[model samples]
Target: MGVVINQSIKNTIITYLGFGLGAINTLFLFTRFLSDEYFGLITYILSTANILMPLMAFGVNNTIIKFYSTFRTRQSQNTFLTLILFLPLVIIIPFGTIGYFAFDAISTWIANDNALVKEYVWLIYISAVIFAYFEVFYSWAKVQMQSVFGNFMKEVFHRLATMFLLFLLYLEVITVDELILLIVIMYVIRTCIMMVYAFSVKRPTLKFTKLAKLSDILKYTTLIIVAGSVANIILEIDKFMIGFYNILENVAYYSVAIYIASVVGVPSRAMHQITNPLTAKYLNERDKVSLKELYQKSSLNLFIISGFIYLLIVLNINELYKLIPEQFGSGILVVFLIGLAKLFDNLLGNNNSILFNSDYYRIVLIQGIFLAIISVLLNIYFIPHYGLNGAAYATFISVFLYNIIKVSFVYRKFGILPFSENTLKVSILIFISTMAFYFWDFSFYPIMNIGLKSLIIGLVYGGICYYFNLSEEITKLLNKILKRT
Candidate 1:
């Protein structure tokens, strides 16, 4: 738990710093510098690549984490690492070839409604390949319990690079198309740097000698492809579908709202980087007591922290929107809906880690496939009528229902819940705070209003939590911070 908290804090700070850079790009630069169509085109391209990344990687990223702890001996671990490293080539080579032979058909299908997307379809392929290997290497480091630097690479490096690229575009030193291409190059560079770091953490000895449960590893990886795809579709398919059903400009507008809402999820995203490998370690060791404690602590702490973020985003959202262009600001409802969904996601704690790392993943994968189907249907029905707001509706509803199913499954199977007494208390505090401060606003510019409101909310929320000593872990962390100060 100490390691979890320590790394989680570091990872969370790094993730937010990355997101801060991204906010500048999303809220100001992209909205101001790039035409909406191009903005949308970029969003559409990346979303498509995300949805394809799972298929291309063939789940090697997850397989590495799940099986790494099971191999007790050094030789077996080396063989395991070497084996998983090349497994994705099985999927990547074939997928790339298919894309090459059927480029026109593939491009046309992806560019269904937005013709501007056809030219960039190849970029999607390249980006997906980069995205796939990046994960493989990141997970490569995760099994070693060295995630902060990798998390930085994952969350911050690319955004910082993009910010630089966006500025170059603003200065007319580069065209928008060139900016997009440079972004892909940046991904390639990021992945290479991560590869170097991961190798330094635990140098991989190329061992071809395989004398272990290779079949089990292959089976898990095969199934995890669907698992990864389902997760990606639920999160990203909205943007992809919006590209198909609407114009490219709508994608940009929706992207901005999604970016704002995604901030609330920073804690969970950071925590998961560490919790995932830890959960896998516990499950592999059959340490139920430790596992359950991790589940509950992870849930409560994540809820308290992310719930504050949810308040900050939802409460100041109006003022925040005032800073952005009005066209992009239309997704106020989108921000709230998806922002709440993100908070709900945090409430699940390490539920995803438990499910994905456990043997029961097959059942959960089937459930995920079903939920993914529902997400697609919801988007299809809603996007035509509601546009960006409709996409948000689909995301919120799907995520809400999906979290319920996952939480229920974990309880029914493991008989452990992620919630604790503090869970309800945190829920109450968030509700009361929302009610208390939501209608309260400052009469000032957007930046000033946002800052003042955030300060009040943070003080009120943090002060109460610290005074009450809400969770022992959180209180301890606060004490440490105070002493250091």
Candidate 2:
């Protein structure tokens, strides 16, 4: 628990710092320096690549975390690592070959509505390969009980690199093409660094000995590809579909709105870093007592934290949009819709961790494939009609439904719920806080207004949670902070 708290706080800080840099790049730099078409093209390229990442990864990342603790001997661990390390190529080689042979048709299909993306089809493949291995190595390190460095590499390094490239673009030192190209190179370098760090943490000998559970592992890895894709598709398919249906700039608009709303997910991102491996451990050990406690506390903490973030984003969305360019301002409704969906996501706590790690992953994963199909259909119908808002509508509905399925499944199988009396308490507090603080603002510039309003909101929110002891862990941490001050 101490390790979870310590690393979660660090990861939270790092993740927020990265998000801050991303905000600058997305809201100010990209909109100011890059044309909406180019921004949308870049977003489309990355989102498409991300959708392919799970397939390229072949689910090695999740497999590593889930299975690593079960292997007791060094030899077996080495055997396990060796298998997963090369498992991705099973998909990558054939997939890449087909992509090469049929690049024209595939790129044409993806770039159907937006031709600007055709030339960048190769970049999408390269980026997906890079993204896959990065997660593979990140997981390698995670099973070593070391995640901070990888978290920094995951969250901060790439964005900071992109920020530098954006500045170079601003200075006329690089063309947009060069900036995009350099960004791919930046990710390659980031992944290589993570690979090195992973080995530094645990350079398990690469042995080719047959793993004891090769059949089970390969089966899980293959199934998890669809499962992982279910998540990525839910997250990024909106942008991919937007690019498919409309011109590229709509993706930029949708990307901006979703990016703002994504801030609401930062706490979950932070805590999941440590909690995931821990949850895997508990599940592997079949420690229901520990699992239940973690499930609820993580939910409570993330709900409390994300609920506050949700309020900030939804309440201040109008003022927040004032700083961005006018053309990109069409996503205010997009932000609101997606913001609520992300709040629902946080409310699930460790639901994702538990489900993915449990024996029932197979059934839930199959269900996820259906939901992925549903998401695509929703996007197909909505994006053509409502444009950016249409995409948001599809995403909000898909994510909300997906979360609902995951929670219900976890409860029905495990007979445990993530919610508690405090969850209801936090829900009420969030509702009251939103109504009280919203529809009112300081008479100041957008930044000043956001900061002042957020400060008051934070103090009030934190004060209420602390005073009521809604979360003993959080309350204790707050007590420590108060004592230090």
- Write candidate 2's Cα lDDT for 1-485 as tens digits: 88989999999999999999999989999999999999999999999999999999999999999999999999999999998799999999999999999999988888894567888889999999999999999999998889899999998999999999999999999999999999999999999999999999998698997689888888889899989999999999999988887578898998999999999999999999999999999999999999999999999999999999999898788789999898888999998899889899899998999999889999999889999999999999999989999999999999988998999999999999999999999999999988998899988999899999989999999899999999998999988988999
Expressed as tens digits, the lDDT of each residue in 1-485 for candidate 1 is: 98898899999999999999999999999999999989998888889899999988889999999999999999999999999789989988988899999999988887874567888889998999899999999999998999999999999999999999999999999998899899899999999999999999999999999649888988899999999999999999999999997578999999999999999899999999999999999999999999999999998899999999999999998888888888887889999999999999999999999999999999999999999999999999999999999999998889998999999999999999988777888899999999999899989888899998999999999998889888889889889889999
The lDDT per prediction is 0.92, 0.92
Clashing pairs in 2: none
Candidate 1 residue 374 Cα shift, in angstroms, is 0.5
Residue pair clashes in candidate 1: none
Residue 234 deviation, candidate 1, in Å?
A: 0.3
Q: In model 2, what is the error at residue 33, expressed in angstroms?
A: 0.7
Deviation of model 1 at 478, angstroms: 1.0
